[model samples]
Target: MQEWQNACQIAAESAWGVTTDATSVQSMAYDAVRDGTSLKSQHAILATHRVADTLRSITEKHDRGWDAPKPRFTSPTVVYDERSMSFLDDGTVSLATTEGRVSATLRLPDKKDGYQQQYLDDEAWEHTQSTLHERDGAFFLHIGFKKPAEPSRQPEYGTVLGVDLGIDNIAVTSTAQFFSGSELEHRRRQFRRKRRRLKETGTRSALRTLIGIENKERRIAREILHRVSNGIVAEAERYCCDIIAFEALDGIRNRLPAGDVFHSWAFRRLIEYTTYKARSAGIRVTRVSPEYTSQRCAECGHVEEANRSSRDEFVCQSCNARSNADYNAAKNIGERAVRCVQQSTQRTSVSRYALKSGTVTPDEGFTPRDGGVRG
Candidate 1:
């Protein structure tokens, strides 16, 4: 496996430095792995595929108007399809290595009782590919698979669950649920203080310990975010919510100082996990513009910056309404999501009429002017 990764590393470096052309890079490095190494012919081909994938990603990023630099590999991982690996009956996986084909027993975690049968059944679940990686002195296998998506049992009439993600509490829901982190925040501050002390000491051991602490913190944060997301999704399910709404929080860092506070908050990961879990349970996830959500009053259609008296307080000057700032924002997000859905439905109807009347054109498509429904 190490030999295979070394070959791939060479191939990747060649692809980035020598030429961006994947075919030429593959052709150049193919002989090195094929003739000089003990790696099988198929394994060598897979190495070339990895090089091609890296080059393709760079090219795609550039084409998308990103000033992407040539990528250099930082870690070694092997991607294998069913053709290059096999799953044994006794819950073991056999994969090709540079030495030879080797088999390993998979130590899978216990799954939910109801999902166990469905996950093990071939008709409902299908393994597509797998990747093997080493992390923190442990080898792990991440397998991708296809499963039958449950039919959406969306409620015809149900509440909208709004979630506001922030650095203070991690997440706040429209249902007045607060996932606080007072203790967690204090622990993180302790970690930060320790990190500063280690940096001041400037010793090799301290630096190494700092790195280990950072890794440990990251793992803890990831696990906590997963739990929080799960709880949010579970809340939505409990309330019989039809839609889970979140703010479109792209480029928010540019608007605020991106220090340790912002970096430590795993808002994006929380949302990603929440949406994934919601989708599996047939819940609709919606993103609405976050403009003035915090300032706007959920009790009334009042909009003013002064409505936000403080970071954690919201007292509307117009209607004298009061609530938790994050809760109000979450409520506003839910309202916006409802409006967005309504607008979308209106646009669909208008487009259908235009199509029937032969008024729709291929070039211009549909515009805001084409939509008749307006607030």
Candidate 2:
């Protein structure tokens, strides 16, 4: 497996060095490296997929008028397709390697309700591709499966839940729920301090400790994100929300306050996690422009920088309405999503915004009314 990974990495580097086009990179890379490695034809071809993916990413950035550096594969994983891999009835997987074919026992999860079990039990899902991953001297196989998606609910009749992401508060919902980032930030600071001390020590043992610390920090962040995402989905479900909305993350760094540390990837991951979870609950996720969401008043629709008195407090200058800044922004995001869906070409009828009190049409504005359907 290690030999296969190393060969794939070299082939990917060669492919990336030769061509920038994703369509032809696979064949060109295969032709160049097929004679060099003992890997089977299909396995060599699969290795070029990594190079093609990187080139496609670079091309997308270029199309968006952004500069992106060439990707360098530090630790490449070997990809296996049907031709190079097979699952036997004896609970073993036959995989093509640089040293030739090898069979390994498949370690099925013990949990009956686990994702692997659920997919394996479902006849509708068909196995697609799988990747071999190496971590801490252990090898694991990640299998992929695909099935038809359920029909989406029409936005015209959907209830929208807005979510605001920030540095201080990891996430804030229009429903008045907040996930604080204080603990995460404190843990990150501690990790940074420990890493600094380890670097100062400049010992082999210290370097190993630093690596372990980094891994632990990643695990902590991932766990927190999962919990926060789950909570966000649960909030939407509690309100019977059909759509979950968020501010678009493009140019988010510029929108944030100066000198504030932002983890763009974390925010993106949160959105991705929420999307998959929401889909399972028959909810759709959408994004709206971030422009003035923080400044705009959820009550009077007033837009002013003075409305936000601090990182945590939002006092509307026009109506003197006081609330958490993140909550206010979330409301604005939800309102924008409602407007967007209402104005969409697919929406021929009036669309309503979901609030804690009830649902209101765009004509009624965001004002709270008495005695209506509960959100």
Candidate 3:
């Protein structure tokens, strides 16, 4: 039981105001408390003291700077399996474990219910798959849970499934999406127009209203990403691919900042959610260096930036290959991931040998050395 894990579990359960008994918290600490020498030791209160010291530093940084104090503690805090030491009147809570429920980290609660099963509003809370950070007074919860165990992943026959993510399209797979960007883009256009008008006013109130618009846009993009990415992953299962690849984001959010007021890009968020979803299904996700998958001919690997003219159209300069922009990106991502994996296997640290296994002969199954398995 690592100390951090101990702290997080306390945070997660604390969301429901369920604290491990205070008596339990103290009893565990009793040995240290009884020994005067230990209690006076510098590392005696390492868990609580470290966070408090951090909080003070954060407060000082904000106090000296412009703008309001920074937010480090988050709304709806919870730490799972963190040993419960104490819960103060303030939001801060102390935690501990016996052997220690160290595996659990504090997180926003994600309970399973009929609503999630049916995919109701899609805005409901879900579990966090891995731990993240808590800095200053603000906390961030990575709002999705590890996929449940029952939906067993069959060994995907193919090793590649292509993925493409974009601002307008959100995400496009080798298989086309049932949903289109028409409605969402319309809303975005309307907001852009309104935002333009607000900018013309050039007043502080107008600036404030811009934040609301930015938040609304984020809300819309997330809603779209959540619904779409899940569907895409479920669909990829049809191909039985063991590996899924997406275009490397490459600081794309910075490339397309939604003006000064609104800035977070939900496209990246959708990919993150999808990556976890795929991982839970025992599928590998690889991000290849996004050089020019769309512009370069997927057929000849022709490198040309001019090949991609419109959001939908792709025309190669050298090889005369052409395809939809998203589809081309998806295919390139798949091919690149495959090549990268092959190269990795050939690296010096690797032995270049894999055990030939099970009900088949030594060379019966597919081999990467057989000039690249397209499947």
Candidate 4:
């Protein structure tokens, strides 16, 4: 793996040197340097492919008027295609190396219903490319698979559940469930203080500790996101919702305060995690325009800046409706989602809005049906 990494780096540097600009990147002959490496022919070809991909990415950024720098591969990782790697019948992985082919046992979790077993037992999922990398003095292999996506459900007859992401709270649902961000913020502050102290020390040990701290922080954040996303999906399922709606995050960072810049990535990641999880549960996820969602009154359709009394409080000036700020925003999001779908489908006879209790309509305010309120 080390030899392959070095060879790939050298080949990529050579490819970078030969290619003058973005226009010539596609037509450039990357295969000319294949014979110059000690790696096997197939591995050498894959290295060139990696180099071409990197060059293409860099060139694409440059084309977009961004000052992107050339990429350098400092980490040791080996990319493998179908021809260079195989899963043997004996439950071992055979990989091509500089010293010829080598085989290793592929370790997996013991759980019978684990993701690895789920994919392995299903013949429909086809294995594709993979990457082998080292971390924490241990080697790990990341395998990719592909399967046909299920058909998406129509939004016309769907029950929508709106989700509002905010700095004060990690997430708020139209159903009145809240995932507070206070604990997360406290942990972040603790990590920040520790990092600052370590930086001030300025020693080799401190540098190593910093790296460990960063990794730990990332793990904690990932775990928290996974939990939050799981809760979001569970809430949708609890309400028998078919569609989960979120505000479009086109310029969320610009809208957020300068100190809350870091939370922008968390917001995006939460949406991504929820989308996949909801899809797995036969639910559809969609995004609606975020314009005036916070300022608009969910109860009376009134739009005014003063509707939001504070960060956590919402008081409608027109209708005197009172509710949590995040909950009101989530309700507006759900209403907008329903309106958008109804307009797109041209269903003028009846328009339905999803609420915590049940579906609501213009004619009936809130009627009880099947242990839930319907309008």
Candidate 5:
């Protein structure tokens, strides 16, 4: 049994179907054999492979492209429902569930020496539904378990990180807003140009080649987000900061002008993904109203046409303040989240109890948890 540690991992939920392919599982088992490890059961191998890949991915993200092995944390537990069929059931070289244990952790007979928790650690965990997705031929279980805790006090929060999310670059944070050089921008621009050319050459071979292009784009985009999110969270952690804040950005896509292409490339998806990663790392993410963050000047709180000098530069005419366009926006987002959190804490609330001993106090809209809202 291995020692249990606090961790976060993303489980694969295929976008297309239920049940993973037997081929994929068999390949993984063979790889296990090649590595001098005995072959584990199919389900156990599946879960282990997933854990390895997800952790490896996140490491490269924070390491800034340096090669590193994936970090290991937990044992994979394969699960099934009451009516589910199992080849291992009724005997025939199949493993059965061990008794008196949490259903999520599966014990592999092969790795009789795998991670076994001595006892519950008093940490509260919540099952976060990663993606309501499909795989194989049907939708299967793919839930992520993470430690959720209450934060104590906030950071000085003197410096705010403003973030503006867009299509190619999902999130252009304050750091990138002020520090990213022309190299990064040029690479992104070149990628877009190559992608455009790939689309125009629409033959069967071209279309086939586009798949690789698409995968590269997807991987690059995912990696960029990983790096940006890691950098932001790392900076917060370095500064002893408590809250990582941004706008709710709930419906900005729909609010855009008609035929706007930004809708095709979802910005909120990036925010949601980044928040999940940020929250898991213990860096709290706050959301504020996204009404007029851009138009308003961060320095003087002035709203005028002259504030935005160009697409990339912002100059406040009211106070003669000048800064990168995105820096101002990131600061705006940080300011809003900080103000919102402060205001939210000051509001009063009374718990109304029912006469009946077991009557539940309805968790109206938001349930108060550990002093922060989780509902």
Candidate 6:
């Protein structure tokens, strides 16, 4: 894994500042393969293609008027597709290594609690992509699978669950559940203090220790996020929620002062995990604009800074309503999700009538029934 990561780092560094095209970079990868870089040709191509994709993403973000910085490649995982890797019925994965094809038995948690066993046992699941990487002192293979299609049942309660994500409290829900980040915050502070001390000492041992600590903290954070996201899915299932709504927080840090710190929080990762888990359980996730969500009062539709007197307190000046700021934001988000669905339904009806009358073509911005277009 370390050797593959080293190869990827070299490939990424070579591909950057060259071009934003995958095919072109892939040809460069072919050249590297011909030069016998130890890794298999397919592996080298995938690594170069990954770098190309990353560069393209950064370029696109910059074109969209974002001050996106050039991405650095320090340690990158080796991505393998079906052509390069195979998962057998016995739960063993055969991966193409530099030396040749190698097989590894995936270590998984207990099957009794429906952990990784579902994916391993399901015959209907199709392997898609996998990543091999080394973290701390362990090597892991992260695999992706696509399950057979099933009819998704609509939410029985016909209600949307609004989730407001914040740094202080990881998540606040319309159902009045708060996922606290107090412990995470305390640990982060402790790590920060230790990191500062280590940097000040500037010893080789301290630097190595710093690396271990950082990795440990990252692992802990990911575990906590997974737990929180799972709890959210469970809550939605318990309440029979059809839709889970969240803030479309694109470029949010840029809008807020002292924003770099906000970037450290894994808000996007939390949303991603919640979305996939929700989808697997037949619930849809919706994103609403974050503008004024915190400031707007859920009770009276009051919009003003005064409505949020502090980070944690929300009081509406119009209707004299008070609530937890995050909770109020969640309620507002839920309403927005409901409103969005209503508007989409209206548009669908109009489009259907137009189509029947031959007044308009489907190519002219008619939204699909899946509700892909949103405000």
* Residues 1-375, model 3: lDDT tens digits: 233434422322222122222333333443443243222222233323333333334433432342434223342433332223332334233343334322333332366543333322232423332223455755543333443332223222235666766655656665444446566677778989999999999899999999888777766755666667667677666544566667666634444555622223555666765765676566666677877666666556777778887778888888777778777776666666666666675221111111111111112332343332123
lDDT of 2 by residue, 191-261 (tens): 99999999999999999999988877866776678789889999887766788899888845666667555
Candidate 4, superposed: residue stretches over 4 Å from native: 1-156, 345-351, 362-369, 372-375
Question: Local distance difference test, per candidate?
Answer: 0.67, 0.75, 0.50, 0.74, 0.46, 0.69
TM-score of each: 0.52, 0.56, 0.48, 0.57, 0.48, 0.52
Looking at candidate 2, the ten consecutive residues that score lowest on lDDT are 148-157
Model 6: pairs clashing at backbone N, Cα or C within 3 Å:
none
lDDT winner = 2
Q: Model 3 — which ten-residue stretch has the worst lDDT? A: 351-360
Kindly report which residue stretches of model 3 are placed more than 4 angstroms away from their true locations once superposed: 1-158, 198-209, 251-264, 304-311, 316-321, 345-375
- Once superposed on the true structure, which residue ranges of model 2 sit more than 4 Å away at CA? 1-155, 257-262, 346-350, 366-375
Ranking by lDDT: 2, 4, 6, 1, 3, 5
lDDT of 5 by residue, 95-129 (tens): 23322222223333343553212112223754332
Give the winner by TM-score: 3 or 6.
6
Backbone clash count for every predicted candidate, in the order shown:
0, 0, 33, 1, 9, 0
Name the 10 consecutive residues with the lowest summed lDDT in model 1.
348-357
lDDT of 6 by residue, 50-94 (tens): 767677667545433457776655664778888899877786888
Per-residue lDDT, model 1, residue 5, is: 69
Off by over 4 Å in 6: 1-157, 251-265, 345-375
Model 3 residue 321 distance off true place after TM-score fit, in angstroms = 4.2
